[model samples]
Target chain A: MEFNAIYVIVAREFKKFIRERSRLFSAIARPLLWLFIVGAGLSRLVPSDTGVSYTQFIFPGILGMTILFSSIFSSISIIWDKEFGFMKEILVAPVSRLSIVVGKALSGTIVSTIQAAIILALFPILGFNLSIVQIIAVILICAFTSFSISAFGIVLATFYESYESFSVIMNFIVMPMFFLSGAMYPVKLLPEILQICAKINPLTYGIDAMKHVIFKFETGPMSPDIPLIIDAAVIILTSIIFVLIAGKAFERKG
Target chain B: MSIIKVENLVKRFSDITAVNDVSFEVEEGTIFGFLGPNGAGKTTTINILCTLLAPTSGKAFIAGHDCIKESAEVRKAIGIVFQDTTLDKDLTARENLIFHAYLYNVAKDKMQQRVDDVLRFVDLYSRKDDLVKKFSGGMKRRLEVARGMIHWPRVLFLDEPTLGLDPQSRTNLWEFIAELPEKNKVTIFMTTHYMEEAEVCDRIAIIDNGKIIAMGTPEELKKAVGGDVIYIKTTDNASAKNEIERLFKFNVSEKENEIYMTCGMGDTCIPEIINTIGEKVISVRLQRPTLNDVFLKLTGKTIREETSSGNDIKDFVRAYRKRH
Candidate 1:
């Protein structure tokens, strides 16, 4: 992996992401809508005995949603590159295919991290207070989640030839991954099958880790369903697996 | 020494054999053309040579590196302008070139100088700052060519570089392409179905139905199809052909009210032919054989006739939509 080759690809992708103003606007706006409108509306219905506001409960989930949507959509540029013939240029370069994958994955991770940071700015508004340590932990978790999901997007992008097919497949997978990850509600309260599905979702660990950080600060004693160590381990392992998958898929382009 | 060499290369896509047992060599510092109609495996052969598509059997090498086993080395030694425009529409021409330079590992300090030189070579330096989407088709094609050359590779592969351009732009592009060998010391391997375009090449291989039917310099291939071609439109064409055949001991073919004959020297034979076969000649045309005629004589059909079918039209439209 030539560092220069990787840097060149990363720079091009970042430039495109920054230039598209509408995309930036939407990346921030989509999750905020879900966080405020949906979270606020649902807060009224829940009983007060849970000891956490609905906004604070769903805040990590919204952060996961922001990272998920932004990172996955960043990979759509690969489909666009294929259609426009720019992919041939990249594939034929002297650099290894791994560099291209790294470049793309890192750029997507950056975009999603930035989007999540924007949502994080509303922490005071949601009436949640946290230490500097918790903020750093949340950022690191979001980065790992963004990297894994973006790698998954690249794997899907490699198989799809058009934007229409990619979007269709994304909708089918993304919604289920977010909904079943216990982003909206507690996994302990869900039915047995749904809880099992949540355990399988990699995003579940990401959100769980974040929730642990926030609730640990608020409630003083930590009692996460999954240990923080296990959550971090799963997210890191999933990212490595996805990066390998994406690299292999890229090498097999026909 | 040969800059490119292929031995019995074959590429198959499911039921279709895109390139079938094709073998050829391109010498260093020369322009080699692959002339074929659409779907005739021209692009497939180029792709295999450029290491974009792996051959199903046999092998190819670029600058002495096997395209498959040593693809990285081969890629380092060669450049490619694909059949379609590959420039990033969102980036300016200079940005596109700069991106390629870094990808190829051109030295950081030399990058600006190299980009400027190639841009000026293609006469695109003035428009370097404008986004590629604002460029004309000719400008975009020129920028693609410049981008391909940004790394300063030893060889350049252009797959149908002028496939869809106006006459003026096509001619201007060819002028720029023709100069690359002498000016930049880069060997060119290009593919085109157009006969006139192949004439500019130092040597050409005419491919049909996934096979190389003829290979030679343009003049040598034309001569192999015999000398000048004479087309005669006359009253009583059958008798006229027979009379000319008997008088000149030449093989004449007739197709729909016209008599076609290949002679050693058409102009020298024309007067004797007319005088001997008196009064029946309405008109006579004597012309040198073109690559199209060479293709026709070798494959029994013109390139256009082979691809002018209804299905080909649909494929053409589909390809057009894909490119635009």
Candidate 2:
């Protein structure tokens, strides 16, 4: 059965992730730097009319940013595998292409969620008093968000075979997704066209779901842009669709 | 029995015909080599047989499984060591083998034994725990070979297995590869531009420009060249070429200031030529026909004339674009 193949691909990627200590450090460090540096500096200029401070306002978005970068870049290993010739080893095996795609998505999900959890753990220091239920809810949202985004990244990975091309395209998509995703500001504040773009972005709903769980604001300027159920549903549905697309991409290549 | 068969195989990349109307059969339990220069379609043929490529318009079978229709089965029956190193540099040597075993669906109970046995077969057991990144080029290659064999494939496809190794390492790696078919009863299908390396094969097909120009055993190929070769460098090669042809009635060719020709008895001809030739005799040497000579005799050009730089660019471009 290809279950063993999937297990081994995941195991191999996880082993590599662990061996690269710098990756772990940087994954965790990137989110915290934004929280302290950007969040602190922007908090004074952007006054919070709502009860929450600006730093507290953007906390969930910070977690979303963590997931966005980690989940998306995790599939960069595909480019690395191609460059280093390791992809040929896996491609020539008896395993189905679906198994390989599922394995990559799962590993990226796990790795990204771990980084998100570290950022979520800093909530207390950032002055948010969260109960255990909210923390679990946030972790669940991060996992779903990471899986969908990672699968999307895999779809992008299938288009190009070089690191330079992949990075150039990633920067084009990732930064705008972050800025317009209501991560730093509310979606309502964006220009109409960009707000449309933000609404279409999967990360927007992810961060909005985090807000729904953390703040529990049902209806306010500070409330989540989309309903909690809708956010969860969007993430789950996109994850399936993206995984199928990536799987088909691999199948067509062979 | 023939383990691999290709009939009228053709693979075209838009305008370039990489493997054009190729046909061959590889016998079971014997080393069969595809001898060709870079971009002559050696790797392209191997890729088609290994199920990594679908031929443009032909049928290929591996162990009775169709390469295109039954690719998964074909893949299961064959293992490939590509031209470049494919080992996971961050993983230990044993980890790489174990990963490969798992991918091939090796039984969990037998996984440990097979991994250990293959590592030992490659003589890498002592350094099984070392990361591949720490290994030298030769060690990484040995580890790759060990990984390729962990699943006990019926046919092992080695594409330029010794392409970039030092002489000692090349010989060392060949020792392990040369022992596989005899010791393990596995049919080995490999490709090499190295004429000496082609000599190890039980049978060879000389491919050039996407077509098999000649196919036979090494001895048969050498015998086809006919007679021994005598190369003479005189102070005046123009006169030497004319003098030798005129006196001995032999067909002589001049290349790089050296006049050479094929003669039935080079031992006797060398002295006769030296005594009769008018030009001053500078140096003389006689050699039995080698595979290089066989190649030269067929194509009128040495295989070494085509450098490997073109293949490097092909690899680079292949890495930059998705395979069609």
* Clash counts for the predictions, in order: 0, 0
Best by lDDT: 2
Provide chain B's TM-score, model 2: 0.85
Candidate 1 local lDDT, A1-254, one digit each (tens): 88998898888988887888898998898888998899889989865454777777889999999988888888768998998889999999988878888888888899899889889888989888888988988999999999988888888889888777865866798888899876888777789999999999888898888988877443321225677889999999988998898999999973
Off by over 4 Å in 1: A217-224, B232-247, B251-260, B271-283, B307-324
lDDT by residue (B212-266, candidate 2, tens digit) is 9999999989889887778788898888788778888999987657778888778
**TM values, all candidates:** 0.92, 0.91
Docking category for candidate 2?
medium
Chain A TM-score of model 2 versus the true structure? Answer: 0.97
Considering only chain B, report the TM-score of each candidate against the true chain B.
Answer: 0.88, 0.85
List residue ranges in candidate 2 displaced over 4 A: B231-261, B264-284, B307-324
DockQ of predicted model 1: 0.76
Question: What lDDT does the true structure give each of the candidates?
Answer: 0.86, 0.87
